[model samples]
Target chain A: MKKELEKRTVTGPDGQTFEVEPLIDYYCEAHPTVQPPAYSKIIENLFNWARSESIWILGFGTGCGAIEMRPLMTPRFDAYRYGIQWRPTPRQANLLIISGYLSVKTLKRVIRSYEQMQSPKYVIGLGSCTINGGMYWDSYNTIKRLDDYLPVDLYIVGCMPRPEALLEGFNTLKRMIRAGNAEGANTYAANFDWYKTNQKRVIHDWDMPDYNW
Target chain B: MQQFEWIQIPYSLLTLFIVLNFGLLLNALMAKIAARVGRRRGIPIYQNYIDLIKNYGLRTSITHGIMFYLGPVFRLAGGVGLLLFVPTLYGSEMFSNLSFAGDLILALYFVFFGALGMALGAGESGHPHAAIGVSRGLSQMTMAELPFALAVFSVALQYDTLTISEIVKAQQGSLFHWTLFTNPLAVAAAMLSFLGSMMRPPFDVVLAPQEIPIGPPTEYHSSYLALMQTNRMIFPIAKIVIIMNLFFGGATNWPIFFAKVFLIYLFAVFVGVVFPRFRVEQSIRWFLIWAVPLGVLAIVLV
Candidate 1:
């Protein structure tokens, strides 16, 4: 565990001392609950449509495939017109694009980020690597199947999928969302222990909270 | 002065609704214009609305503390308060809103209110990036506001009144009587300061979207983010309305109001597209050296 995250005593400016457990004090330990769809079907549909139209992507480049995402913002692709914006913070983003191979090391951070994101979030397993480890199939550090760890909505399979393929994948995800098919966040909450065990099996040193939120 | 009436509440709300929609559309239009400059297609005009809905629709929302909850609330309040206090149309009773005696001072206070509230709220979030962003934002805002404050004071000095309606009334009757012609230096100073406040290029380091993980709103999400997004639409238009009333002649009705507001907003976009971003210290120095002098001269000449 990090020193900052460890239980310790500290003195304040007024010379008062108090015990502080970093992990307990800093993070919310309550587990995430499965949030049901809106009460009315019509309202749910409206929300789902809005979600599909405004895809705020968390711009965390996990692997080599992240290079492909840059083109989506360029003139040729121009994903902005489609309402796909790249948000720097995980908090503001609803779409997590796991762009390529996820090493055990990177997966730890990815899980943290993924957990921090608000519910109704969708994850995309980008490239062949995230689908089945691609060229790093024999490597010990690489995560073979992305679905074993996170609830992946769609997979754009390629060594590194072209920007066009990624766009197609986004379109498909939008369709899924509009159809009320993409409930990955709920799925993850329902199978929390199963996913946590899978994550812990590969992560080894899982010092952080079970749920980052 | 007109007596306070029970009808003004709904009247003001009507004005708020109009400005809110106008602000959202204007934001998209400016973005489209910026994208066009880069040879790329921009977002749809309705993208802001969709984004707002999507954010509000998110099921889960985490908070650092009570302050985090108030941050966006305060920001929205600041935007709303600024708009309501200032008269929208010059002479129309329906659209005049809640403008009262000495509204210019209140408008100025409201301008800084949101940032202060956000700073406290972001501080409670305990993100280092938020802290850095807040510090940078407040400093930049202070420097940017200097020329604007001076220009406002100069205009108040020029017209010899603090009431916005009176100021607008003075600028009425002819094009040459507008402050842009009557007090060009103050207009120039305020226009330059306007770029800084607009959060576009050259002064956008406060948000620094590429770096520091999006500044003060790093820890904000879901409904909290939705509130801030609402303010983002309203605040800019409110500021533009103040500028329109002060420099250009105040609008008489919805169409004229729309045209003046769009043109003023375009001026900021025009400057934003042409210039590259400046570092915080460099921008502060730029404002002090160039903009502040013009404002001082405006006051001196008046």
Candidate 2:
């Protein structure tokens, strides 16, 4: 099993081949020094909103994070009762729930989808993996800090955030919606520095292939 | 709601002749226009007859589902039913004075049912792309129906009778002079809704071939597919005839009626070629936000 796992190598967009495990460990250690209580509260308030309670998710299960969304939607957790159904089309989707790290290949597609969603849409970063590169820290292909590119509303901690933890993240979102605070969406649009910086970094990497196509 | 005697053989024969084939001639003409509008080698005037006979003679593949079997039959039946309901000619009655007070509603419902049956059959045929197409088709129809219904009800209100004959009688003037001119709003709404409902373009998201391989009927093949194609070709003519009879006089000579229906068909073809299909949700949003409000405005004005 170890040998088979060893054979599987995830190449980064920059053509880097750092071992996946150590890359993840080194990245998780580099955490944000500040965790704003106001930010957390804003997330909680969004969940409390009446319309936010039954928030339907755009049913996109891309990676490991996608697997976790299943239980959250099933009977045990039963997200549907809260009006959280999966929408098929981007135009109908109000919330884009990105489950895990996005590959360079998928990142552009995600951007297209994000753009397609009408204004007042929120992006929920589902796992620590999505927060700051998590396990894919040195994987040149995997985007570190998905928020660095796309504005993420709430990032649930956990290499793979548990289903229960996902619920907490959802509640946080509902609270934010209730406060009539569309700050997350606004914040994403306002802060282009992170996206621009990462865009430069990824583009500058000599090994990374041209992404204009 | 009065029951008319059904014992009259002439009534049945005339009903068969008019209802079964009222739109056949008009459809053949429309096909000629469609071919030209599409910039394809146009079929001869008698092409529809050849195709009809070929489809009739061929054995259709019965996909196991009940819907697959029922779709084409319903379209044919609905076409006949709609033709019978519309007031085609005056004084020269056929198949025993078979006019009803609320036949227009029935005619409208028949058109919807036929379109729905085809969509449903296409949806259930185990093709993901087709299913998506059907869903889009249904969504578009849902949007289109609002304006169409509002317009129909407005016309019903004007004549104080649901029958086509009563509606036509109320507009007994020159050929160009009709209820459509009197209630322009309803007429406009009806035309817009009909364009979308018929899945004509911009609204043709249901079967966008480039996007999803003929959409719902993507899996259909051989003769079974032919029935659907035949129905698709023939059914639009029925819809066009109904539109013509309502907007222009149905019996006001072949030339005038054909011209009006052709005009409607021409606009639909232009729309089809000009605009791209709307995303399912976007189309719905458009219908609810714009079409519904416009329909209400038309109703109020009417």
Candidate 3:
């Protein structure tokens, strides 16, 4: 059983073989639920309501879907109407939107950003590209099934969804939050090892620290 | 009357709670009005409360150091203290709070307590943006305070007392007797400074939300952000109350106080929306070039 899980070794371009820690053994443990307990129903409800209203999204745009997000900030859709704001740093944001196709290089950064964000956070996968790699279905670098790597709370389907669709998606997300159904971060933590294995199989550079935290 | 001693704690707490909530309400109102100007639907009036509660509810946060932990505490303390230091109603002991702590000079200096502590705390945050923000904020604050200090000096010289209550009493009894009418130049200079100190646009480069990603509070989150949010509400109201007392004639009742405070806050919001932000150096130059001469003129007139 002990031998079944071994440290990984990757050869760099410089011909250096470096031993790398697999994310499963080196990262994430299931933590106590962040929400106030059921006994404190009032506090829990208040928290959920607050969380539903104010959603700060990380400003990490991945692909063609990023163009659609700009219109949401314009006079047209105006997502701020729903208390949706974009935060520059991952540390302070609660939502991550994976737009369009994810190339292997971009996926590395996405994983790092997702791990850096505080818990009780979420991941919103956008377009057919994220769902099934869309036009990149046969490409070598673009990921086909995003859920196999990161836990996606919502999958917005389209080649490139319009702003109206994005707004509807936000509304759907708000509803899920109000009902206490969005638990992607917690789900990721609970199944860390399985997710890590899937993530490590692609992109073989494997040079980062064990846990971003 | 002896029982009053026992109730001071609760009374002061009640006043603080009212001010905090009212501050949030006023902020929401201001944001909504600004949104209207831009032809967009804005947030609900009670959104600040929701935001505060949500921040407190965040499950995880990382602290940079002990100073970072105390930064929000210092800011909140300064805001609450500033509010309590002033006598709210003309003749009500119930709302007077701890006004006996000190007088005008103390209140003037107390405003810096928060800024200084916040800068120190942000320094410890280790973010280069926080440091940049602190530098800009402190330098701008130095210039901004000069006009206000001069206006206060003029009022103190005109009234012959540095006690804020006495200054308020001096402005009473007639509509035309208020300093806004009586010392229009001083009020003009001080109000100009007020716009800068409140972090309205043209002077809001420090929190240019999208530009530098919230500047000084870049690393703050959860309850720490909550504390800063509470200060965001109270500190401006507290400063406006001081200016209102010194220049607008202190309110004789609660209704008048609310109207006066709203009107004062509205001026800042109006200015914020119509103009774009001035870079830190430009804003400082703005205060010196325009506001300083007006301040000197007001002082000379007195």
In terms of docking quality, model 1 is: high
Better of 1 and 2 by lDDT: 1
Choose 2 or 3, whichever is better by lDDT: 3
Using TM-score, give the best candidate's number.
Answer: 1
- TM-score of the A chain in candidate 3: the value is 0.82
Model 3 lDDT per residue over A1-213, tens place: 234346878799999998875545454433323343345778777777788899988998998899999988767777888888788878778899999999999988999888777767888999999988899999999999999999899988987888888889988998998888988887887777788888889968766653565
lDDT of each: 0.93, 0.62, 0.84
Q: Candidate 3's residue-wise lDDT over B1-302, tens digit each?
A: 12237576777788888888889999998988998897877777877888888888887777778999999999988898888888776666677666652378889988888998899889998888889889989999999999989888888888888888888888899978899998888898899999999888989988777777778888888788899989999999999889888999988788898999999999999899989999988998999998888889888998
Top model by DockQ, which number? 1
Tens digits of per-residue lDDT for model 1, B1-302: 89999899999999999999988898999999999999999999989999999999988888888999899999999999999999999899898999999999999999999999999999999999999999999999999999999999999999999999999999999999999999999999999999999999889998998888989999999999999999999999999999999999999989999999899999889888999889899999999999999999999999
Ranking by lDDT: 1, 3, 2
True contacts kept of each: 0.94, 0.00, 0.55
Looking at candidate 3, what is the lDDT of residue B131?
90
Return the lDDT, model 3, position B224.
88
* Residue pairs of candidate 1 with colliding backbone atoms: none
**Models ranked on DockQ:** 1, 3, 2
